[model samples]
Target: MDWSEIIARSEKSFWGLLGLRMLSADSKLVELGLTVNESHLNSMGIVHGGVLSSMMDQAMGTLVTAIKNGSQGVTTHLNVNFLSAMRSGELIASAYPLHETHRTMTLRSEVRGEDGTLACISTATFRLPRDSK
Candidate 1:
């Protein structure tokens, strides 16, 4: 399947609002890229936790949809850990499923800076589509 189509469908939503791009994707994994700018910064001039969380959620959710053959699901829980501060530069988030059941999929993700620093780590659980297992 053309995973790019999944990202294309998100273009008009918050994904587009944040200028996130699809770096790569497959049936089991998804990677997203974002260039951190002032708009993504917090009061301390560092990347905000929300931005990191959103990026991780997007990647994980996209993976779920890809594996489900384009059926979308909703995020049920998200946990993010900030490891380092990011002031600027590119951020890449990669997510893949860690576990799955009939109703839920849990994914693990990491956001790395351009310099290859582990800026954040995240894990999220998405509720699969009603008709998906």
Candidate 2:
């Protein structure tokens, strides 16, 4: 499926509530954005790690979906590195392909906050469904 359809379906998901926007989606790249708000903050008054992780994971998985020509998949593994703290601003995540096969795809992603400061970096592997239909 295209990003538009995926995002449209996401409209009622937990991630969708974060107000993520699909900036780009194609074979080579996938980028998404979310504006930080009170609902996204952690106890320390910064964007929560889970939120960052979720966005990064989604970015990578969506990229894999695009690269797989619309095949559905789920993240099997995700590793994240928190580089900086974000108080409030737009947070963006972008992913690029690292490796792939007929059944699996690996990708690297990064999250940036205001002024393009790096907030998190992540690597993920997505397992495509065995049944395409």
Candidate 3:
């Protein structure tokens, strides 16, 4: 699918207000790009943890979706490590599948600033739904 279609679909399906454009996606790898707007800022004018968590989730979920056939999954657990502050600007996140089984998938992601500084690292576990069809 095209970038516009991906963005639209993600926004509708995930309620992700931020326009996280997919830069690339393939088996085992996915890259997402986003810009922090005012809505994403916290009271301190820095990006909130929730926003970073959402971005991490999206990156990890998109990686899982690329590998799965017809099944979908929901995040069962997420662990995040914040390294540095993220101010309002552009950022990129890359996610890859670290491990996968019949029922579960684990993904590792790193959020980086425009200057290539590491902002955060995250891991997420998703429980794959049983295919009914």
* Per-residue accuracy of model 1 over 12-92 as CA lDDT, tens digit each: 899998989999887777999999989999999999999998999999998888788777779999999999999999999
The deviation in Å at residue 113 for candidate 1 is 0.3
Candidate of highest TM-score: 1
Query: Which parts of model 1 are misplaced by more than 4 Å?
Result: none
| Residue-level lDDT for 110 in candidate 1 | 92
Identify the superior model by lDDT, candidate 2 or candidate 3: 2
Q: What is the lDDT of residue 131 in candidate 1?
A: 93
Worst 10 residues of 1 by lDDT: 1-10
Q: State every prediction's TM-score relative to the real structure.
A: 0.94, 0.92, 0.88
Per-residue lDDT tens digits of candidate 3, residues 1-133? Answer: 3446555666776435776888888767888888889988899988888878888888888777777743457999999999999996898889989988878999999989899989899999999877612
* lDDT of every predicted structure (CA atoms): 0.89, 0.87, 0.82
Candidate 2: C-alpha RMSD to true structure equals 1.7
Top model number, lDDT: 1
lDDT of 2 by residue, 70-125 (tens): 88688889999999999998889999999878788889999997599999999988
Evaluation by TM-score, superior candidate among 1 and 2: 1
Residue 41 lDDT in model 1?
A: 96
Instruction: Report lDDT (Cα) of residue 132, candidate 3.
Output: 18
> Which one wins by TM-score: 2 or 3?
2
